[model samples]
Target: MKFLLVEDNLDLANAVTSRMLMDGHVVDHAEKIEDAKLFSDTGEYDLILLDIMLPDGDGRSFLEHHRAKKRDTPVIVLTARSQVSDRISLLDLGADDYMTKPFDHAELQARVRAVLRRNHGSSQPVISVGDVSFDPVAGQMRVKGTPVKLRNRELRLFELLINAPNQIFSKQKLCDRLFTFDEDVSENAIEVYIGRLRKHLEPSSVTITTHRGLGYKLDPR
Candidate 1:
């Protein structure tokens, strides 16, 4: 999953980002409210990990602003304030979940997955496209019940396509979704990954089709 982390604490932010990367998630970060708003405005993240105390503004206000604009991306508030009232207020103001400071990295990761799963309408752990199945949490794919070995880039492209099947996504959109802010890669890289994915899923029951003027989509025909 791709996440946007909004925290002004540089040390904490780096630690969290590193752990998330180790766990195979793409993470982008913004240290202030304005930077966070800029990233949120783009509407790219599957979830937002927000800190209540930012440099320019409070996180709750940011949440209220985004909620008013109808941004439904799941948000998990990370704050030093661990009081019951604070938690209640955060949830009441439209935050999806809450985690306190100095948290267990594993618990935070689990919370991220839980929020994403609840938002995406995924009943089963595995998402199926034709005979192929993908596990979003584990980043695993199976073809006809046989495990398929996919390169990291190919897996990321397939994950994005399968998660939102039938939704046509342009190459640029795919790049933003699959890579983190710090990772520098070319737009042509998406095409290369897609081409490799087609070869990997070859002779399979599923198909990834290109829409002439639009982009590419996964069709389970």
Candidate 2:
């Protein structure tokens, strides 16, 4: 999943960003409310981890504006406020969940999965594409009940494809989703990853098809 992490503390932001990346999710970090708004304007994130106390403005205002625009993207607010009223207020502001500061990384990850599952209306963690099954939360893939050995890049590519099967992903979109803001990716990096993933899925009923001048889509063979 792609996420926008709106945090002002460099230490907390880096820690969360590292853990999310390790979990095979693309993340963009913003230190101020203005920066967060800029990233949110792109409409590329599946989720947003918002810190209530931001440099430019409080997160509640952002959430209020976002919901007013009818954006359904799920938001998990991170704040130090432990009052019940505060939590309720955040929810009323359209936050899907709330996590207090000094929270565990594992707990945060689990909450992220829960929120995403609810958004996608999935009762289980595994998303299946024909005989190919992918667990985004577990960062694992299996073909016909057998585990498939894949490199990190290959797994990331497959995850994106399986999550939105049949949707065409352009080369530029793939590159932007796979690489972080600081990482330097080659022009053909996405092509190489797609080539590898295709071979890995060859034995399964799932197929990745190129759309000539367009892009690629995954479908059941």
Candidate 3:
């Protein structure tokens, strides 16, 4: 899954990004409200972790504007405010969930999953493509009831393909979702990752097929 993190504190942002990276999720970080808006405008994010106090302005206004535009992307507010009224106001402003600062990474991740599950209306988050089953929250895959070990990059590629089994994903689109803002991705990065993911899915009935001029899709054979 791809996430947009609106945070200004370098240390905190790095810690959170690192933790989520370990779970095989792509995270994009923005330090200011303007940059946050730019990221939101250009791409579709699975979820956004927004800090209440940004360098440019209050994120509440951003949330208000985002909701006003009918953008239903789930937002989890990160704030230092602990007052009940503050929490209530944030919720009223269209935050899906709010987490006070100085938070435990585990709890924060749990809340993120819970919010995503609620947003997608799934109680048990499991996605399937043929005999391959993936738990999005845990970032784990199982083939025929047996767990398969995958490198993070391979797992990320498979996750994208499995989530939209029949839909074609262009190389550019995959690169956008797979790499972050600062990474130096080679021209053949997407192709290489796709090749790696195909080998991992060999034991399962699912196969990723190229669409010639279009791109690629996961085909269940």
Candidate 4:
């Protein structure tokens, strides 16, 4: 998953970003509401981790403006406030969830998964496509219950494809989801990852189909 982490605290941001990366997520960090707005407008993120206390402006106003635009992207607020009223106010403003500071990393990850699962309308933690199964939390893939060793990029590509089986994903979209803002990635890189994934999945019942001029789709073989 791709995430936009709007946090001004350098230590906290780095800690959360590192953990998210370890969990197989691409993250963009912004220190101010202005920077967060820019990143939100320019990139596609599965979720937003917003901090209420930003250097330039509070995240409450940001959430208000974002919701006013009718953007339905899920937002999980990171706040130091412990008051129920504060959390309620943020939720009313459009935050999907809130994590008070001094939170458990495991709990935060679980909340993230729960929110994502709710957003995707899936109750299962492991998404399976034919004989291929993927555990997003563990960042593990299995084919016919046997572990499938894949490169990091391959795993990410497979996860994206399997999560939305049969949905056509354009090369550009895949590139955007797989690479970070500073990474120099091209459409050819996407193809390379796809090719590698195809080879790994050849023995399984799932296959990736090229849509010619369109892009690619994952389907049952």
For all predicted structures, in order, the TM-scores are: 0.91, 0.91, 0.94, 0.88
Clashes of each: 0, 0, 0, 0
- The runs of at least 3 residues in candidate 1 whose Cα sits more than 4 Å from the true structure, single-residue gaps closed, are none
Better of 1 and 4 by TM-score: 1
Candidate 4: where are CA atoms >4 Å away?
Answer: none
lDDT of 3: 0.88
Query: Could you give candidate 2's per-residue lDDT for residues 1-221 as a string of tens digits?
Result: 68899999999999999988787788999898888877787647888999999878888888887788789999999999999999999998899999999899999999998898888777667889889999776678999899998877788788889878979999888877777666788758888888888888889998899998889999999
What is the lDDT, from 0 to 100, of the residue 59 in candidate 2?
85
Query: Candidate 4: what lDDT?
Result: 0.88
The digit string of per-residue lDDT tens for model 4 on 1-221 reads 78999999899889998888877788888898888888888788889999999888789988987888788999999999999999999988989999999898888888998888788776768888888899875678998899988777788888889978969999998988888777887799998999999888988998999999999999999
Give the Å error, residue 59, model 4.
0.4
Query: Total clashes, candidate 3?
Result: 0
Per-residue lDDT of candidate 3, residues 89-179 (tens digit): 9999889999998899999989988998898778778998778899877778898879998888778788888888879998888888888
Write down the TM-score for model 4.
Answer: 0.88
Which candidate number would show the highest TM-score if scored against the true structure?
Answer: 3
- lDDT of model 3 at position 54: 88
- Of 1 and 4, the candidate ranking higher by lDDT: 4
